[model samples]
Target: MSVTAVGAFTDEQLELRKTVRALLAKHADPAAVRKAAESERGYDAALWELLCQQVGVAALAIPEEFGGIGATAVETHVVFEELGRTLAPTPMLGSVVLAAQAILASGDTDACERLLPGIAEGTSVAALCWTGAEGSWDTDNVGVTAQGDVLTGSSHFVLDGSYADVLVVAAAVDGVVALFEVDPAQDAVTRRRVPTMDPTRTLAVVEFAGATGRLLTSDGAAALERVREIACVALSAEQVGAAEQALANTVEYSKSRVQFGRPIGSFQALKHRMADLYFLVETARSASYAAVASLAEASESAASDAAVAKVYCSEALQSVTGDSIQLHGGIAITWEHDAQLFFKRAHGSAQLFGQPRAYLTSMKSAAGLTA
Candidate 1:
């Protein structure tokens, strides 16, 4: 069945999906992906610019008034899925989806007007630093403290933080958790590139040594919760794509490789494994699509939908990628193989927004179920 039929995608959205896939096929081929993975920015600079400028992907979900395409969450998910399929590295998720949405939710019109236009134009990158030591979407653990317009303390596991033009930090202000926007170039703001499980994506240690900030929202704790929910949905969409690609590659390898004068795919064991992976992929797709629909409608149950999507999709992708390597027997672990890339990406992404169990717990709470 067509994705549109299953996910309620419009005709335009289906076309958008095709266009995104074609673009990735041209620019994000395996060689380019490997080169980008080793590069300093962790992505093809030219491809990133092309996607942002020519394809206008960075502006997909932003409002038209803020120099965006004024698209919906469905379109955003479609773009992310294509990115994931190729394992393309970019700041669309960090700058556009998470940080831009946080700005809009902040009720700070001036911040939106000034910052969001640059984000839509692809000239600026932003990272939202919400998690601290605990690394689980908890506001109480946010170590940064805001003293008037100055921010102090440090945050870890900040995604895309090393290259961001703007930093939106979740900090405590006068005992209330709030969102603070800071310029990363400032002397007081230090960004140290941190080792990550996936070098295709970058993380940083951000230290605010009395760094000056512009308050984005007084109710930052709530805004960050919304950002976490939005991020979970986006991350899940990517996981779904990655998992789909892993299964496809594994199946193709099984069909091509020969053993005892027959294709390895003929083995009953391999067939059973592929069937199980297919089921997981489909389940993840359903949950992720449901989250996208809920987010598009701004539904009251969107949080629960996002939690379920994260838990199911992350686990599914992790499992798919792990088996993808095993399905290849040994070649999958070699330096030249692309399967390892997907495996590393899946491993890192599984813990990106929140781990599977954390989201599962949230889902239960949202559903009023006992732990």
Candidate 2:
């Protein structure tokens, strides 16, 4: 798809993006972000409330019947982009996007009725436990096993797992994958927050030992695949936003930091590097927009589009953030600089969901191309 076709945002979307950016600017400055990341809950509760209550961000993709805005993935992408721009530590990804979408995709109306409203209002955080210790997020890598209605095993790298009110689990049942809903407060569930390189985000390891679960879907492989595609698209948007912000910050720094009695950005070598970084950011935006548009339309090519976006955006963000650190000089290495955080986020996000090489391999296999 052409960039013009997919990159054009509706007026309402532009306004939504503006409002979110303004809110983050006022409440999620670097200091506040650092504090929130260090908080027990790993996020700014007040800021999250404002985003959900005022902006209805968490409800954007839920159906109207479920107390949501009844919008499409495009709106979710918009919100995620803004969140990524600031590296805001919110559960929107884990609760609102991944787990919430997993539930919706299950075709379990009762589950939706019983659980969605709280998620829509951002009062209840949901964690999707799927990946194993390897963190591949693949169907074969599912960590949990279900015996009848009881779940056992451990899921690693679960976003917000430690404090989530609800758990949406993917487990193997009779050699088939299924989705289950379990209360995190259950006696059989144990969640431990894990240390990660990216302080701006939190992950947990959740272990279940015969925890009784409400089955959401017996045939969950299809739903899990769909959720992964949607997640890839959503995450591509985040990567694009973060890359743009990282490049912007680096450019701004280059304009002020002087060397040889002139701004470093005035140097031809640095100028070329910044220009190249700008290209990566723009191209990543195009790829993300294309994937979002395809997903919004339910296009047949959506899966491939998501894979492409995931690969391209992940690399772009890594490149931009790495260059950002270099452009900012030694100051970027210090804790006082936001460049370090962005760099860490870039590397962390690249590994989230799945790595770029994994996606590339999948894409090749999908095309029946022998490596």
Candidate 3:
């Protein structure tokens, strides 16, 4: 379906999606994707400029007073959905999901003012340094330590950590959680890039030994709850986009590809499968939108809503992507096929806010289920 066919969004958002999709098509074509994935940096610098500096996608969520487009999370979701559709190689997830969110939610206006403009302008790259092993977003799980002005220990599975100029990291010290900024140029910090299931988005292990950092938030524990809320909702929205794209691709391919002298989509079996996937994607979208709406109200039920959306969307993306590849046949598994990219994105994103199993546990708890 064309982007405009999505009825929930505004005309401006539709135009924005169309423009960015075209930009990605021209700048991040197959060869460009291959080069970015194979290169040491894991993304195209020139294309980054075109999107962030010229196109203004990175600034979408930043307040206009701080050199941004002053967009809400819903608008940001639209931008990311198109990026996912094109599988564009950019740090949108890392920057917005991790760094920008941490800074914005930290309640450190000075820090936000100082850092966000550079991020919006594409002059700087920042990543949130946290371990996937931290599992859910509880601050008590933070293993990295910070004392005085120094931070120690390593953060594992850090998204875009290897490439970020600034690292907004979570750490614990004296039983208090804190957010610290680690400068990558400092010798006390070391980064090792890890090969990720999704090559389009870079991941790394960041080691800090007496790394000098500026503290941003003193109440890391409280801030963590808020940060996780934002991450979960934002991720849920991204999944909505990914799920939509996968279903659309699957349906489009099924309609065109022929077998036994007729379109395979005409087969009852495939039709049933596509129908199931469509239901899953639509349900996920509703859950995601509800969560986003709840977040805007700062509703006390935001955590539960976010959890529901996360779990639902995560499973939906996984199922939809699986069906997408299956429907596309063997061609989907090929490295050259866009289906593989969507597959990787599904796996990578599914685990970002804890796996579906973990969220399911949270969901059960939300439903008053006993441990």
Worst 10 residues of 3 by lDDT: 1-10
Question: Candidate 3's residue-wise lDDT over 1-371, tens digit each?
Answer: 11221236667777787888788888877678878877888888888888886678889878887778887666666666677666667787788667887888788888888999998887888988865356565566675898888998888777778989989988987878888877899999999998889887788889999999898988877776777777888788777777887888888898899999999889999999999998998888788877776766567877888888888888889889988888898999998788888888889888884777887786778789977
Kindly indicate the candidate among 2 and 3 with the higher lDDT. 2
What TM-score, over all chains together, does every model reach?
A: 0.96, 0.98, 0.91
What's the lDDT for all of these models? 0.86, 0.91, 0.80
Predicted structure 2: lDDT: 0.91
Residue 362 accuracy (lDDT) in model 2: 84
Alpha-carbon deviation at 212 in model 1, angstroms: 0.7
Pick by lDDT: which candidate is best? 2
Give the distance in Å from residue 112's predicted Cα in candidate 2 to where it truly belongs. Answer: 0.4
Ranking by TM-score: 2, 1, 3
Task: Estimate, for each residue in 1-371, the C-alpha lDDT of model 1 and write its tens digit.
Answer: 12331586778888888988998999999898888978887778788888888778888888898888988888889989988998988888888887898998888888888999889888888888887777776865687898899898988888788889988999987788999889898999988878888877778889989899988888987887888888889999999999999899999999999999999999998899899999999989999998888888888888888888888898899999999999897899997898998999999998887778877776678679996
In model 1, the runs with Cα more than 4 Å from the true position are 1-5
How big is the positional error of residue 51 in model 1, measured in Å on the Cα after superposition?
A: 1.0
